[model samples]
Target chain A: MAFFAAVNNWLKHFAYELQGEFLLALKTIAAVFRRPFYLPEILEQMHIIGVGSLYLVILTGIFAGQGFALAFSVELADFGAKNYLGRIMAIAIIRELGPVLTGLMVAARVAAGITAEIGSMKSSNQLDAMVAFGIDPIKKLAVPRLIALIIMLPVLTIICDFISLAGSWVIAKYIAHVTTTVYLSAVRDRLIFGNLFIGLLKPVVFSFIIAFISCYKGFTSGGGTKGVGRATTESVVISSITILVVNFFITKIVFSQLKGWL
Target chain B: MIELRHIHFSYTDKPILKDVSFVVEDNESLVIMGPSGSGKSTILRLILGLEQPQQGELIIDGDNICTMKEKNKRKLRKKIGMVFQAGALFDSLSVGENVGYYLLEHTNMTLKNVSEKVVQMLGFVGLDAEEIIDTLPDELSGGMRRRVAIGRALLSTNPMIMLYDEPTTGLDPKATENVLNLIMKLHQEKTIASIMVTHEIIDALRVANRFIVIWAGEIAFDGTLEQLRSSDDPRVKEFLRPFLSSFTEVVQKRFVEGIATENNSASL
Candidate 1:
């Protein structure tokens, strides 16, 4: 009975937070078209979320692609199918690894930053001040970040996909001793327009997940600076987990559609 | 005008304001005095519509805030401004930008016009706009930050009613005097309805035409300074005891010195 009661309470709390997040997402999406566009603020967040996370995205992309190429070469060699290295690497990286890694990196960087900044403003009564002064913090704060993430995450993920393939090409040519022409042709063969389309699409969903989770965490934080720190940690952890969970379902749908395309 | 009728507010089941009622008419200032954590700030929060009371009618400028929608409440909020305990200036903005924040956001004023208004408001607060325009909130001194916050709210909305949450607490005497003088100046020049929450007895006596003292989440006394002086309430007396003794100490010495001065003047 005690175990059941504990589980019930935890479920109830989770449901409450989830409901709150849904409403916040709806409000943020609606606010995107409302007046007071805050162009300067949106541009500022673009620089922070898109430009600031570039180094991490590049680093993750190249390393993951290189590692995958090394592992794939050994397996393909086993079957005397070394010629298929580029296609296999391309399918895996663009269809899954590239977007997931980019999403995870942005979650760690941008989401944490958003949570800490807004959390502190909330703790210190600045958000209340904005409320008191007839300014909506959601429109002023969260909407700009949302717009930035939605616009930038796709761009970031595309770059990541390109860089990852570049890494695969390098590894195929230098490490696996495959010719450049073969590597290029194989990668080109493996890509359908649908794969690239889905690769680009995943980051838009991921960006929304990261922005929504971080903003919600920030707005609800309390207990001053310690609370802000806790919110930052939670935003990063929750955004990362939610992106991965969502990635699984999204990949399933995209694969089904791609099979129809085939 | 602002009125709170039987306001009831609590935090996580701990009552902070219970059946508290007060009114401040247009062109009037009400100063609230209370011990720490006695719901003085909660009253301001209710009126600001930042926190709705569990039970009450918060009337402001002819509307009930308790029933207002969040969107409507934000519109209602433009008529009010507040200065917080720690200034609460937007840390990301420069001083001039903070002062003109809402104006820039909501109004169609050109950049030059907004800059001019920012400079004028900073001047009203006795600050040099050119000197501090580029300075961040963290870069300013405590007194300067408080002044900048006041400038921000006052110039941003041109609010009809203002609320101050212990603006003078933890300040040196000179700085405290400057803030008090500024409050009086605004009262004189703008005829703005205002509520100030402070435990500073001298400030309450000086600034308020009417005062309310809260004790244990209820109003223990509400009246003029003279009425407060003659109150038989035990809680009010206990709260005023330290200040009363110090006041008496000064008066007693002054009375003795008056006799000596009178004799010296007579001999001369």
Candidate 2:
């Protein structure tokens, strides 16, 4: 009887948590539609999540694109396939590197900040105070940041793709001494809008995942300072791992279906 | 208008409040006194609906709070104002912002009206209206922060009940008097029901119409202040013995010192 009771309680708690997540999602949607658009809050979040991430994303993009180009050039030269350097770099960054790098950078920078701020508010009763005052904290706090991330992450990924390709182009032309004409011709021949569109898609999904997970963790944090710390760690770890996992599944499914069309 | 019937609350495995019951009437001041860790604050939390009692009913103004839904709980909470032990003001917001938070969230008042009300509350709390209302919580003195917390609680004007937990703790004599006077004045003028938890026996006696003393997780004494003062119970006498002894010492020492000094002066 006790074992069955414990199992029943576990099921109950699981259902409760599921309901909470559903409510949160509904609240997020409602908040986006209800209030007058807060341009200032969106702009602030953009500056924090997008503009501040530029340096790290750019640095990673340069190294990743250049490294892939150099390594592939060496291997392909042995088979007389060195001319494919531009194509490889363009495809690699557009289809995978751009989204993955940008997602990881955001998981580190933007998601961590969101968790810390919301966690502090949770521990201090500010969130409760907000509820007591008839303000939906999910609307006031979470939705603005989520919407901002959705808008900003894809834009940042596009910027990263452009910069990474530029880095590869410079390395191919200047150091490897491949002609500028050949590099440009190779990229123009191989790159497609589908590649760019697929790259852009991941960041939007990543942003939503990151925002929802971090906000949920922070909002549910208990046990004060230790709880806040645990939430922050969980936000970063869970977001990064989820992004990687989601990226793989999305890539396989999207590319496989596209291949069928081809 | 708050009533608790046979409340039993615990944290983890230890009981904090067992068989605790009390009723607070409208416009009446109820002071809950007890030693440290006697669960005085837990009672306040239960009344605020921040915590649910394990095995009893909490009815506030004819509604059962324990069985209420979350939305209704929030509605009930709005009718209540609580001054936490640490004031618990939003550290990120300014004094004015903190006080005006509820008004901005709940009402359709214009910013101008909110600003006017903020100024009025600050003035009522004896805080300088012209001073920088944007000063952060860390910038304010302890007493000032407590006053701002009180002001924030007063923002929702005409809450059915006000609950204060250790409101006068960590204050100098003058500041304590200020807080005590504020509580009395708010009670007298607004006719708001108040439940204040404090260890300051004198302050409680000064403002309380009814006193409820808890000992070891039970309601040990419940009566008017006159009844409490005249009670012959050993626990009551033991608690009040320090104050009574101090009073007698002052009187006896003054009499003896006066006679000795006069005799010495005459002999000289």
Candidate 3:
């Protein structure tokens, strides 16, 4: 009886949190269309998320691409199919690995920053101060962040995809003994519109998941420093996991719909 | 004027304020005193429209805030300025930006003019505007932050009321005195009713013309300073005991001196 009661309470709490998150997302979307848009705040966020994450994304793409290419080269050597390394690398990196890995990395870094900054403000009563001053925190804080993420995440993923392809090229030429012309031709042939579409789409969804979840956690955080710390950790963990989980669903849905195109 | 009628508030299943009622008139300085968690600060929150009571009518200058639309409520909030605990200055903004935030957002004031106004307000609050304008809240001393917050609250042109929630909490004695002095200065300089919530009775008595003590979510006592001193309520006595015991001589002497001064003025 006690176990059932606990489970029931947990379910109720989860549902309540879900409802809050959904409402926040709706409000943020509505706020985007509302007048008095905070252009400076949006530009600042774009700079922070886009220019700030450029180096990290580039590094991740390089290493991930190189690692995958090295493994593929060795495996294809055994199968006497080393010539197809570029095609396989292009398919895996662009459609499957690029968007998901970039989302996870960006989530881990950006979500924590967003949560900590907002959570600290909350603990310090600045949020209440904003409310006291009659400024809508969602419009002032959440909307700018959501807008920045929406614009920057796909851009970052594209850069990550390009860098990863370059990294794979280097490995394929040096290690797989594949000719550069053949590898480039193979990659160009396989990099279809469908692959690019799925890759870009995943980041857009991931951006929403990261921004809304992190902001919600920050806004709801309490108990001072410890609470802010807990919220930050939770934001990163939840955002990363959500990105991974949602990536699967998006892929499943898109693939089912666009099977002929793929 | 601000009125809270039969205000009942609860954050959860347990109630924080039960049937709390009070009225604060224009330019009236009110000191709300209570033990911690007795809903003293909650009253200020209720008035600021930061939190709505589960059941009550909060009328600010005739309109029932309980039923006011959120947009109208926001407009109503312009007449009320709040100095949250520890100043609650925006951490990311510099002191000047924090003080001029309202003007920048609400008014069509030019940046140059807003900067001048912020400087003037900061000076009025006894802060050296040039020295601190560029400084962030985290760099300032506790007292300085509170002063910046007070300046921010008072920056608007037509503020009718000011709410200070534990404004002097977590400050040194000198800092507390500085903040209390600033509050008294603002009260004298502006036609604004001030509601201050504090645990310090001496500080409360120094600034407030009237006192309301909340004990366990109810008003235990509400009257002038004289009535508060002469009250026989056990709860009020218990709450005031520690502070009054130590400062009885000082309080009595101050009252006697005040009466002597009044008598002297009457003779003149």
Candidate 4:
């Protein structure tokens, strides 16, 4: 009975948090519509969240694609199926590598930075100052980040997808001595627009998860400097882990439905 | 303008304010005097609606502030301004921005209008409006930050009440005199109720029309400055004796605590 009671309490708390989170999201959306457009702040957030993150994302993208292609080519050669390398590379890049890796990189670069900056503000009572001034810190600070992530995540994922595939293409054509014509044909036959579209959905969900969790952690950090550090670390770890888990479940659902739809 | 009745607050299981009660009339300046850990600051927080009393009523400006919703509480808080012990100025914003933050948010004033009002308020606080308006909080001296904080509080444009928590904590003798004078001038000119919490007896005697001394979470003495000075009460005598004998010591201690670390590091 005690165990059951604890479980019930946990479930109730989860439901309450979900309701509160939904209300917060709705309020934030409403505030964005009500306030004057802070275009410079949005552009600044985009530069920080998107442009500054490019080098890390590209480096990870290139290596992931090359590494995956090299492993798959070796395995295919052992099975006397080296011609399937392009198909494998295309499918893996579009279906999984591009979105998941981009999400993780963004979790490290953007989410952690947002959490640390806002957490420091909270600790130093700057957020309290905003509240005392009747400006919702959520509206001023969180909204720009939320909007930036929503717009930039997809763009980053697209760039990651393009670069990763290019890396695979280079390995297959130049290093592995695979003919360009054969590689292009195999990719054309196997890869579809739906696969890439499915991958595109992950970044949007991951972006929301990252921005929401990081902002929530930072906004609610009550203790001082130590608390800010803990929140920053937690934000990155939680966001990255949740993105991967959500990506897996999304991939399963999308591919299962796609199998029938196709 | 503010009344507390039977306020009971505790941290964990240890009580800080137990059945504390007081009243400050409109335009009246009330000084709360007590030694450290006497729940003096807790009373300020209670009045400012920062902390809710566990069992009591907090009435501010004829409103039941204790039970008000957060939105209503925020509205009520606008009628109140607080100067924290450490000034609590936003380090990220300029002095002018910090002072005019409230007008920018709660009013439809343009940047130009806000800047003008900010300059006027800075002048009222005796700060050079043009020189330090763009400076950050870290750029200002301790006394200047306190003045800017007072300016920020004044920007609300005649708050119904001002709650100051240890306003004279870290200042030299001259700076303390300036702050005490500003408090007196503000009370006389603005006609707003002010509640000041300080252990400094000189500060209490300088501006306070009435005094409330809290001892162990309860009001030990509540009356005029003359009554407090002439009272036979042992607690009042003991509290005032230190102030009377060694005003210089009090000033020196504050200066040492405030400036010593910075000077030591600078020399190194």
lDDT of 3 by residue, A23-94 (tens): 999998998898778999999999999998999999999999999999999999999999899999988988
Q: Estimated TM-score per prediction?
A: 0.94, 0.83, 0.98, 0.83
lDDT per model, in order? 0.89, 0.83, 0.91, 0.82
User: Largest lDDT belongs to which candidate?
Assistant: 3
lDDT of 1 by residue, A1-262 (tens): 9999999999999999999899999999999999878899999999998899999999999999999999999888889888899999888988899899999999999999999999999887899888877778999999999999999999998889889999988888888888999998998997888888888889999989999999999999988899899989989999999999999999898788777652
| Candidate 1 deviant stretches above 4 angstroms | B247-268
Ranked candidates (DockQ, high to low)? 1, 3, 2, 4
Q: Write the per-residue lDDT of candidate 2 for residues A1-262, one digit (tens) a residue.
A: 9999999999997687667656777778778887646667788888898889989889988888888777877787788877777888878888899999999999988888898889988787777656656567887788889988999899889888888888888788776767788887887765676776678789998988888878887887788889888889988997899899999998998887777431
Instruction: List the DockQ of the predictions in order.
Output: 0.77, 0.37, 0.75, 0.29
Better of 2 and 3 by DockQ: 3
Question: Chain B alone, TM-score of each model?
Answer: 0.91, 0.89, 0.96, 0.88
Q: What ranking of all candidate models by lDDT puts the best one first?
A: 3, 1, 2, 4
Error of 4 at A37 (Å): 6.6
Interface RMSD of each: 1.1, 2.3, 1.6, 2.3
Candidate no. 4 TM-score: 0.83
- lDDT score for candidate 4 against the true structure: 0.82
Which regions in candidate 4 have their CA more than 4 angstroms from the true location?
A1-41, A180-193, B11-14, B35-38, B172-174, B200-202, B230-244, B247-268
Docking class of 4: acceptable
Superior candidate under TM-score, 1 versus 3:
3
lDDT of 4 by residue, B1-268 (tens): 7788888998869899988888888888899999999999888777766677889998887898889886787787788888877688888789998899788766889999999999999999999999999999999988888899999988964588888889889899888888888888888888888999999777776677688988888788999755665678787777677676564454455557558878888999
